[model samples]
Target: MTTVQLEHPHAQRRRTLVRGLPLAPAVVLMLVFLLGPILYCLYSAFTDMALTGSSETSFVGFENFRKIFTSDEFGRALGYTLFFTIVSAIIGQNVLGMFLALTMRAGGPVARAVVSAVVIGAWVLPEVVAGYLWLAFLGEDGPLNQILGFLHLPTQDWLFSLPILAVSLANIWRGTAFSMLVYSAALSEVPREIEEAATMDGAGTIRRLVSVTIPMVRRTIATNLMLITLQTLSVFGLIWTMTRGGPSGASTTLPLFAYQQAFQLSQLGYGTALALVLLALGGVFSLIYLRILRLEDGVR
Candidate 1:
């Protein structure tokens, strides 16, 4: 006869702990490399710390937050940041990329290949190099003004006269490739038969797109928006290298503000506080996106 003995509760718990032992090292590495710094930064946000100070730190409550909140420069930076994000990322890149993707999806292979190569080339450039390229392009006596000079058309120094617009345009040109690639993949996954059936039912291109293609790929659109928005919110190198948040802080986004505070002004605590705010904003965006993603899954 074969018999089985039930394990004791303590023994079962020990077995479960042993089973989780392999994950312990990975958990420790993550804590050390990722979560540890974030938590330390958050803790330092409440302190009065300087980049060049002694090891001693003192808590200052919400003084740093209050300082930035009431400062005109911070308010201006926040407003310009929001405007830049909305214009360059949400409107320009997303819309133009979607249009490009749709066009390429239905275009001849040669046209698609050429256009893709051009767009991807711009996107593949390093951020600093792309910033310098745009800087030169928009400078006085550069290609843009030279063309205008040839035609005797009015031309202003683009970067000086329109810093935010110039940077937004540059970002749009560089970033549209990502959104285009995303939409292209999503469009490919869409069932062609549904579109064909809609056509047979006398649906126009716009009608079919509105009622079919968009609905089918709505999840992809939401996901892409979430990713691009977060990325745009954290953009620093391109804006800094090009404008350095110059011309009276016209392009001083949150990240630039943080950098200015931490390294430029030696206000490490204030800068970390700003970083926390950015993190919180990103968290809010992520929550909203997760809800949208869940709803999309449910609908499907």
Candidate 2:
């Protein structure tokens, strides 16, 4: 009777401890890495930290953000960042990805192979290499102009004339594959029987897509949009190597602005604050996606 009683309490203790084991590693890792660094950075952002000891350090509070808001450069960069994110990440990647997925679904093996190869090639290329390749293609005397010359059509400088467009195109080229893969996987889960039922109802391609496919894939679309928006928000290497924030501040998005301030101008604290702002932007998108994902889970 004593043994039984002891075993019951011991078993209860074991069960309680066992239930918490799964959380241990994740909690430890977050404390050591994620939460710690974020808190440190948040504190650093309000200070006048510098690369050199030339300047006196002090707490500046909201002065950094105020400086950013008042600066035309910061305003322009914010506007440009929003524009690029919407155009390249949202419209270009998401829309084109859906189109590609639809095409591949209805296309022959050969077409699918060719299209997939083209997209995967762009996806797999090194960013610097991709940037230079785009540079060569968009330069004043590049092949695009050469082709236009042969066609007896006047050609403008692609990079110089349309820096934002050039970077947007590059981003689309590099990122469309991710969205395609996502949509394709989502498309696969859509029941074939349902699709056929829609077709039997005399629904044309557009009607079927709007009424059936799109509705089914809406969750995937939202998830992909959120991911790409966050990813594109912090894109620095590709755009920097391509435009370097351009002929003026034309293509100076937040990342470029941060880089220019931190490294180029040696305003480490200001740059860190800018980085924090970018982090906040990413957090905003993440929250939206997380809510969407949760809503989808509930629906499912």
Candidate 3:
């Protein structure tokens, strides 16, 4: 009986290991497929690694980073990227998302259906398709200008005159749905009993939202902000498809710069350096968000 008991425990351990065996391959695959490229890119960033031309590509140390700092184009692209991130991801996604969530919470089926249809339509469309849609909407003879013409208003070249704003709006339209879904899920999780208690204690709508709702879902807000910011920071195709980083590079973000350098100008090394900088920027943002999450956890 004692022998049987010991053998049963060993058999269970074997069964557990057998069940977990497949996970080892998955983990190894993830490290190889994902971590390998990231490690390679980080290494390449420090060296003058070219795709073509010179057979004598050597390590240039911080020269690439120095060039990034001194370049006027880099400065402008950084500023534009920051502006787009704040405007579209922070303000457009968070604020608009919250508002949509609140409205939907109070709305009837018809209103909910309408809002869902509109937001989800944008969300479900491919990025390239959304880019074309925005291009048509912002073009010289597009619906926007036509509307202005109908109203006897001055028709300006939206894409030319306001490339940043046009692109920002397009990003907001494309991304607001994700934020809306996040906030909606968070809002739903807010306990009705707690809200009722607040109402009974003379807490107004704004007070309840600010104090109770917001605090309760602070983690969700932080998570959504981090995700949207990361996403907006990496945007290339939308801006490229719309403006091609044109109108004198007014709307050029890092991704566009990288593409232009690598493929357009055939400066593969420089482009990879720019990509490394973008990765660093993303890392910094992630750390900030991580700290916030940790602080929230401590508070909780």
Task: Identify the leading candidate in terms of lDDT.
Answer: 1
Weakest lDDT window of 10 consecutive positions for candidate 2: 1-10
The best candidate by TM-score is 3
What is each predicted model's overall lDDT from 0 to 1?
Answer: 0.91, 0.90, 0.89
Which regions in candidate 3 have their CA more than 4 angstroms from the true location? 1-20
Question: So what's the TM-score on candidate 1?
Answer: 0.90
lDDT of 2 by residue, 21-112 (tens): 99999999999898997887798789888877687889999888889889998888989899899899999999999899989999999999
**Which regions in candidate 2 have their CA more than 4 angstroms from the true location?**
1-33, 54-56, 291-300
The global Cα lDDT (0 to 1) of model 1 is 0.91
Residues 9-90 of candidate 1 have per-residue lDDT tens digits of: 8998898899899999999999999999799888999999999987788999999889878899888888888888889998
Report the C-alpha lDDT of model 3 over 1-300, residue by residue, as the tens digit: 334454577888998799899899889998999888788777777777777776867888888889989999999999998989999989997899888987898899899999988997998999989999999998999999999999999998888998988999999999999989999999999888998899999999999888887888889989999999999999988998899998999899889988898778877778888998998999899899999999988987
Off by over 4 Å in 1: 1-26, 295-300
Clash pairs, model 2 backbone: none
Q: Distance from true position, residue 15, model 3, in Å? A: 8.7
Give the lowest summed-lDDT range of ten residues in model 3: 1-10
